[model samples]
Target: MAERCPYPFPRPTALGIPERLTGIHDEPLVPVVLPSGDEAVLLTRYQDVRQVLTDDRLSRNLDRPDAARISRHNSMFQDPRINPDPPEHTRVRNLVASAFSAARVQRLEPRIHAETDELLDAMERSGGPVDLNEALAFPLPVRVICSLLGVPDEDVALFRHWTSAFLSVSHFPREEIRAAMTEMSRYIAEHISHRRAHPGDDLVSAMIRAHDDEGRLSEYELQWWCRLLLLVGYETTATQLGGGVAMLLSHPEQLRLLRADPALLPNAIEELLRWKLVGSSVSMLRYATDDIELEDCVIKKGTSIIPAADCANQDPDRFFDPRTFDITRSDNPHLTFSLGPHFCIGASLARAELRIATQALLTRFPNLRLAVPAEELKRQEGALLEGFTEIPVTW
Candidate 1:
C-alpha cells in the first residue's frame, strides 16, 4: 500500500501558498490525511480545484454517517448550511441571502467607516507599539457582526471566546470544542428568543421574522444560520485584515503605491485577498457522492476531496507572475474565495471592511511599520484559520 500523505502537507513558510501545494500541479490529485485521521484526495491545480468545487457529484453533506471530516472536533459541530445539499442547502442559504446582498452591504458602509475610524482612534490613543490584530483587525469585525446580530456589548467577549475556541481545530481538545459549541448554541438560543419577543432592525431579528412570519426557516435552521453567520462574518474578515496589513507592511513599495493613490484601494484589496493565506491549506471537506473521473484519477464514492484554493489562487497557469505582489495586476482570477454555490456570501462585506480599514490605517498612521522583524511575528497555530496572532506595529 502507498504511504498516506499527512494532512496540511508541510508548508515551506508561514506565509503565501505552500511550495508543496504549488509543486503538485502536474498531478491530478494527491493523497492527504485530514485532521480527523481520514485519508483523502487533495486537488492542487486551478482547473482541478475548480472542477471539484463546481461538480454537484462532490457533495458537502457531512451529516452522512460516513462523512469525511477535517477533524474529529469539526465532526461534532458541522453547520447544516455548510454540509447539506439542495433543496435543504438552497432553502437555508436563500433565507438569509438577501441580508448579505450587495445592496444591503452597501447600506452598511457608513457604519463600517464609522467603526473603522473609531477603532483607529482607539489605536492612535494607545501611543506607539500596538497589536493591530487586537486593536483593529480583531475587534472591528467582531463589533460589526455583533451589532448586526443584535448581540449585547457584554456578550461580545463571550462570542469571541467561543469563535476562537471553535476554530482551534487540532490545537484544542475535543471536550473544549464541544463546550464552546454548547455555550455558543445556548447564547444564540437565548438571544433569538429575545428577538422573537421584541423584534429589532438587526439581522437576527429579521431571521426570527423569517421563522415566525414566513415559516421559511425552522428553529434548528435559524440557530445554526445565526451561528454560521456570526462565526464566518467576522472570522474571515478579521484574519484577512491582519494578513493584508502584514502583507502591505512587508512589501513597502506596494504600501507606498497604495498610500500615494487611494483609488487603488479597491483593486489593492482584491490583490491582498488573492495574495493572503486566510484559511487552512485545504478547502472544506467535500465528499464524493459517486465515482467521479478527473484528468488522471477516479475519486471513489464516499472519498473526501479537499481542493486547495491557496494553490489555485497562485497557479502559474492561471496567474502570470503569480508569486509577485502586484497591486495593479488585472485579469487576476484568484480562488481565495472558493467558487460555486458555496462562494463566500460575505465577499462584498469583507471587501468593504478591508478597503475601509486599509484606507483608514494608511490615512491615519502614515508611518506605520512593523514593531518586530516579520519572521518574529507570531501566528495562530493549529487552527483552520491562518493569520497573525498579533501584528505589533508603530507609526
Candidate 2:
C-alpha cells in the first residue's frame, strides 16, 4: 500500500487503508514518521478527521512550510479555498451555492440524459475496445460544464489539457504547470470580458451579473471561482466517473446487479465514491497553529499533520466490514468529499451527475466490459486530482 505512493511515506491506499489500521482501536489517531525525517499525524479514524475538519484549532493553509507537505496546490485545497473560516467561507460558498441549487440541477437531468445517450451511442458505434474514460467518463462532465458555462464546446480539448496540467502529479514540470495555469487564466479572463460584453444565461455571465449588481466577489474571487468551477467541478466528477467504471469492471457481479436493478445506482455511486481512490494520494497537510497532543505524539504549533481521508473513510468504528465494498452497506459514513463547514459546495451537483451517469450508462450498455486487464491498466499518479489516464472498455 505504502509502496504505491512515491512520496517516501507510509500512507495507505483506499484498498489497504482498513487493514493498515487494524487493532488500533485503542488509539484515536496514529503518528506517521516519513523517511524524510518529518513527522505527521495520520487520522485513520473517521470521526477523528470529521472532528479535525470541524475543529477550530486546525488550519488548512498549505503555504505554511511547517504544515504537512502536499505535492500540489489544487483549487479545492488552495489558499483561497482552505485559509478562510466562518463568515468568509460561508460568503464564498453561498455566492456559488445558487449556481448549483437542487432545483437548477434537477432541470438539467433531461439534457444530461440526452448527452449521456449520445456519448453512449458514439461508443457503441465505435464497436468494442473503446476507451470508456475518453468516450463517456471524461466527456460527460466536460460537456455539462461547457454547456453551463456558455463556453464553446469545441474548446474542450484545450481546457482538458489545462485541467490535466493544472493538477497533474507527474510528467509535466513546475514551469510547464505554471505556463498552463497562466494560459488557462488568460483564456478565462478573455471569456469573462466577452461575457461582460454579451450577457447570457450561463454561469460566467450570471457571476458577472452578480458581481455587477451585488458587488460580492472581487476580480480575484471571480477568476478563482471560475477556475475552481471549471477545474474542480469537472475533474473530480470526471475522475470519479472513470474510477467508478473501473470499480464496476473489477466487480462484474456488482455490475450485473446494477444492470439488473438500476435503482441501486444512487447508493452504489455513493459507495464507489467513498471507496475509490481519486487524486494522486491521500494525505492532508495541515500546519499546527497551536501545540496539540494526540495518543502517541505531541505536535507543536507550525507542525504539519497528514490525515489520510482514504484511511479515515474505512475506520472500523465508523464502517462495518471496512475493507469490503458493499454498495448497499447501511450506515456508511465516509469522508470522501470531506465534512464540516468547508464541505464540498458542489456535492449535490456532483452526486446528480454521478447518479444520472451511472444509471444511464448501465441501462444503456448492460454488456459493458473492460477491454484490458485491471492491473495492466495505467492510472494518473502523482497528481492532485487522481483518475485514470484512460479507461478502455467494450460494449
Candidate 3:
C-alpha cells in the first residue's frame, strides 16, 4: 500500500487548492477513504490521470455489489444508464452529440450573449451587493440550456432543488435524495408526454422522436436522457461560473489583466476550467473489471478508482508553475474534461457560457468586486457539484 489518506484534503482557503492534491506524489496511486466510507485508489499525477481516462478496463458502472459507492447516497452514480461503457455509451451519446457540437453551440452564442446581458441588466438594476450566483450564474445557464433542451424556464428552481439533492452524498439524508430523484424523473416524464403530442425544434422534441419514431431509445433511457441532460447542462456550468467569478475576484492582478485585454476571455475560461471550480474532485469513480497495473500499485479486480482531474491539472510536470493562475497559459491541456469516449459532451457549451458571461461582466461592470472578503465567502460542500451558493458582488 503506497498510502491512504482520508480523501479530499481541506483547502487552505475557499479559493485555494489543497496542498496534498497540489503536489506531484511519487507514488501517485494511493488509497483513499471516500466520504461514503468505501476506500478507492486515487490517481493524482497528470500523466496517470490522463492515462486512466482512456483505459477501456476502467468502467463508470458502479452499481455492482463489489464496486465502491462514491458517496453513501449519490443516487445518480448507482445507475447503469447514467454512464454505460463503449458501444452502449457511444450509441446514446451519438444521438445528442450534434446538438452539443461546436457548430450547434456556435449558433447558440447569440442567445447566450443576449441572456448574459439580460441577467447583467437585472443585476445592475437591482443595485450593488447582490447575490451574483443567484442573479446571474445560476439562471443564465438554466435559460440557455432550457432553450436548447426545450424545457420551460419556469421550472429552473425545481431543477436546482432536485439536482442539489440528487448529487449530494453526505449533505442530505437518503430519503430526501430518493424523493427528489423520483420527482425529477416524474418531471421529465411529464415533459416527454407533452413533447410526444406537440413536437418542436428543441432537443427534447428530437429525443421524443428518437424514442417514439426511430425506436432507438427505451422508455427508461429516454427519460434518463432528458433528466441527466438537464442536470449536467445546468449544474456543471453554474458551479463553474460561481467558482470562476470567485477565482477572478480573488486574484486582482489576473483580473486586471483579463479586463484590460478582452481577447483573453477564452484563455481565462480555460484557466478557470483547469482550476478546481468546485469542491475538490473533478471526474468521479470507475470500477476495475480486472486487475490493473499502474506506475505505483496493482489495482486488484473489483477495485474502485478516482482519477482526480483537479489535482492532475496542477501537476508541475505538465503545467509550468502550475500553482500560479496564468490567463495567457497557451500550452494548457487540462483534464477538467476527461479523455477518450467518456469526454464531457457539454464542454463546448459550458465554455461558451463562461466566455459570454465573463465578457459581459468585464464590459458592463468594469469595477466589479466582491461584497465581502474572499475567505468569508461560503461554499456548498458535500453536494454533487460543490460551489459558491451565493457570490455577493458590487459594481
The model with the greatest TM-score is 3
Which 10-residue window in model 2 sums to the lowest lDDT?
A: 1-10
lDDT of 2 at 13: 35
Residue 210, model 2: Cα distance from true site in angstroms: 3.1
Q: What lDDT tens digits, residue by residue, belong to model 3 across residues 1-395?
A: 75668777767777877877644466677788888888888877888888878888889887798887768766456786555888778888999898999999999999999898888888899988889888889899988888898887787677888878867868988888889888998889898898888888899998788888899888888888788888878888888898898889889999989878878888889998998686666246898898878776676788788888877888888899988999989888998878888898999999889888888887898889998999988777787566786888998
Poorly placed runs, candidate 1 (over 4 Å)? 76-83, 281-283
Quote the positional error of residue 137 for candidate 3 in Å: 0.4
lDDT per residue (tens digit) for residues 1-395 in model 1 = 24667777555544555566656677767787877787787777888788888889988777676766777766534555454666777787887778778998899899899989999998999997999888899888888888878888777877777877777767788888889889888888889989888888888998898888899888788988898788767988999998888888988999898888888888888888887557565546788889988786787898877877776777788888888998988687777777787788788888888988988898899999999877776667667786677888999
lDDT (tens digit, per residue) of candidate 2 on 157-267? 777788877765555777788898999999999989999999897899988877888887777778887886787678888888878877887887887777777777877
Supply the TM-score for candidate 1: 0.94
Per-candidate local distance difference test:
0.80, 0.70, 0.83
Q: Deviation in angstroms for 129 in model 2?
A: 1.1
Where model 2 places Cα greater than 4 Å from the true spot, the runs are 1-27, 31-39, 72-83, 279-284, 291-300
**lDDT score of residue 169 within candidate 1:** 67
